[model samples]
Target: MNRRSLLAIAASAACLLSMGLAHAADQDTLAAIREAKTIRVALEFGRPPWGFKDDKLKMSGSDMEAAELLASDLGVKLEIVEVTGPNRIPFLQTRKADVVLSTFSITPERLKVIDFSAPYASAVQIVGAPKSLPLKSEADLKGKRVGVTRATTGDVELTKKAKDFGVEVVRFDDESTNMTALASGQVDIVIQEPATLTAVAARNPQRQLEPKFIFTQFPVGIGLRKNDPALKSYLDQWVKTHMADGKLNAIYRKYHGTDLPAEIVKPTN
Candidate 1:
């Protein structure tokens, strides 16, 4: 080969090598966690059953247990970074947290911005109201004030249907505030998960909150930054192993009072 041609080929190989190294560096989240001996997990503390503080002010819930288990399995210290519904993605994107376990649902819209691990949990979004209010269907929501946590799957779904149903959506920053709006008569209805409704009902028995209708059922996944294949693969295997061993199911049942769906425990694929 001519000297000039040899030099050109060497330059191309160098460029390719640089690009590959940059990509690897960007995706080395799992390795970084291991080296650092710590993993920052983002979770919403205001959402009960999934994540919340107990009477003693200690973090307690299914998501908390899941995060602890993940850190333990990785042999890393767990650092809980509190996040609200609207900021879960931002936390991961900004490097404030390595992963998010905040009852985060896996949706196509979200998949565009960030990647997610295999399904670890599931929840159903529902329209809830006091027993005295007859909200059996979407038709009954006309002219009613519906409260929802901002940027949540329920909020997005409910917002799309709100105008058609003649409903007004009042957005709250977190689940706790949304439930408070319902209990304090600030909103006539709320779109939330069943566990959250049960929590609100317990706190205010006079409210007598009950699910009116289910909006949607979604599988929850661990949120990760895009292009982090190492972290994604580790989490996927973690979920599969836990699901098979019944550890994940036990955590779900402990909080939700029922076993995980058949599909989750025995995934089709």
Candidate 2:
């Protein structure tokens, strides 16, 4: 064979080996967690009532509670990593976190890049404005400034139809900062999931940002890397198992003042 032919053959063989190694790496990932007795979870502290740190510097909320339980069930200790809107997936890709338990929405486009657990909760996109600002419909946002978290479903959807939605969209790093901007009148309104934004408003009783959430609804799930297919499947079944035992409902009721529907709560386990 010529020199070029020899190099091509070697490159092809290396590519096959790399694919095999990738598979082993996934198994190795699961094995390392199972053996080490620890799992790392990502959280966006800016989203209160789902995940956040308190005055004592201890993490708390529905997501933290669920993560701790998940780790315990997996026979491991919980390791928490703080993440923001921009870094949540990067943290997973870079091996900084095993799962993203933040309020993540699962979409077909995102599924191409990341795997998702069973739908844990449904979060609807909503518009929040000062009571003084009337917003009966999305079209009312025209000529107004709407704040959203960067790269979120709310941002993607609103930005896609910014013209039809009738607003100039201003994306922010996270919800807490976005809400602050809206409350200060820097933005006319904030776009976010209704339940999450409600919890945020409740947490800050004195500082309220009135919201009229616009979209219908979408289910939220935990995010994991696409490379770890088996891990993703395991997480889906894990969530389904929790749902079967009513543990998931109990968790949501404890934090969000509501219970998941039978359709959404069924254990795929």
Candidate 3:
């Protein structure tokens, strides 16, 4: 080959090699986790059913169980990284955690910031109030004080409609506080996950809290950084396999007192 042609070929090869390395650097989350031999899973210890601490002060919840299984499947040690509703995505964005399994609802708004695996669990946002409150519809919420955990799906969804419904939105830093507000009558109603509302009712039966209306139903997934195709793909497959084998459902039933929705167990997409 001519000297000029040989020189051109060498330059092109170098450029291609550099490009490949840059791409790999951008998408090495899975590789990095494997190399470190540990997966840091962000979870909300204050959110029950999904995540919380037991009486022994040890982490114990469905999300905790799922995180353990994920690490075991990947053959890595599991490291729990405590996160809250507001900061879960930020933790993933800042690489503070390898993945977030903190009852992260997959919404279009959230999808804009981070990628997610297929739905691993399903949840619903609801408005709950005392049974005698006569809240039969959204219109009945007019002028009512509604409590919600800041940045949670229920908060986001309720806030968007609060103005139209004439609802007074009261935000709390966490689910525990939100529930407290309702039980204490600081808020006339609350928007939260059904499981949380149920928990609150069980603890404060005199409050007579009952679901007023379902705001929205959504699927939850493992939150990952955007552009990490390898990590996203691996988690998607992991969720599918576990769902098919009933392991995921078993965990759901263990905490939820019922099986996961069929659509979530066998998602069409």
Candidate 4:
């Protein structure tokens, strides 16, 4: 072949190889899950109802059940990776987990960093304070102490409004600590999701903590890396079908001791 023709052919071949490599990289998570026969799901391991270890340290909770169902749907074994509020998205981003089944709420900030499946669940952030606190609004909380789990939706919401309301915000590592501070009067109030507040109320009846106000309602979706369109599509379809077929509600009921509310089944957006 002529030198010019040979050079052109070699360049074309290199371009093709580069495209093939890019496609292969895009499919890494899905291919690895299939080849390994396991889906590594990140779960918030100490949050009751959503995810937590039982007395025997066995994985069992609402989110765990959801992850188990997802693995079953994919015909794969389940590998639960324990992660916390702030770490789940990072785990997905770093590919340490195939997906995060933690109760990850779909927020614009989070959507920028990772993709989400169709929401499988929903929750509302609520204010928890003693009955006598008289905290009916942000204005009522002015100059009062408020506690929230660091990086949670509650924390984000409280922080966003704290400056306007003059509310002093205390951030804790987890939900338990935030609720503990509220119950012990270390903070005058706390903001948390419904499930955590319910569990805390059951344990601390003496605190007389009541839901003072609803801060925000958000849909919970599974977190995945941005490039996993195939994985995201599969999970989105699974969530929609299961939600329509009552499977999702059954799982929700098993954990929350109540039927899945119809509004929650609808998309937040």
Top candidate on TM-score is: 1
List, residue by residue over 65-120, the lDDT tens digit for candidate 2: 88888898888988889889888888988889888998788887788877888898
Candidate order, TM-score descending: 1, 3, 4, 2
* Runs in model 3 lying further than 4 Å from the true structure: 1-20
User: lDDT per residue, candidate 4, 1-269, as tens digits?
Assistant: 89999999999999999999997786677778999999999988767788888889888888999998989988999998888888887787777898998878899999988898988888778888878778887788889888888888888888888889998888898877777887777987888877788777788888887888888888899988887778888888898899889999999999888877676676565
lDDT of 3 by residue, 160-191 (tens): 88899888889999989888889988987888
> Ten residues in a row with the worst lDDT in model 2?
207-216
Q: Which ten residues in a row have the lowest lDDT in candidate 3?
A: 135-144
Q: Rate the local accuracy (lDDT) of all candidates.
A: 0.92, 0.79, 0.91, 0.85
In model 4, the Cα lDDT at residue 86 comes to 82
How many clashes show up per model? 0, 7, 0, 0
What TM-score, over all chains together, does every model reach? 0.93, 0.87, 0.91, 0.90
The regions of model 2 sitting more than 4 angstroms off are 1-15, 199-209, 267-269
Model 1: residues with Cα > 4 Å off, grouped in runs: 1-19
Q: What TM-score, to 2 decimals, does candidate 4 have?
A: 0.90
Better of 2 and 4 by lDDT: 4
Q: Candidate 3 at 27: error in angstroms? A: 2.1
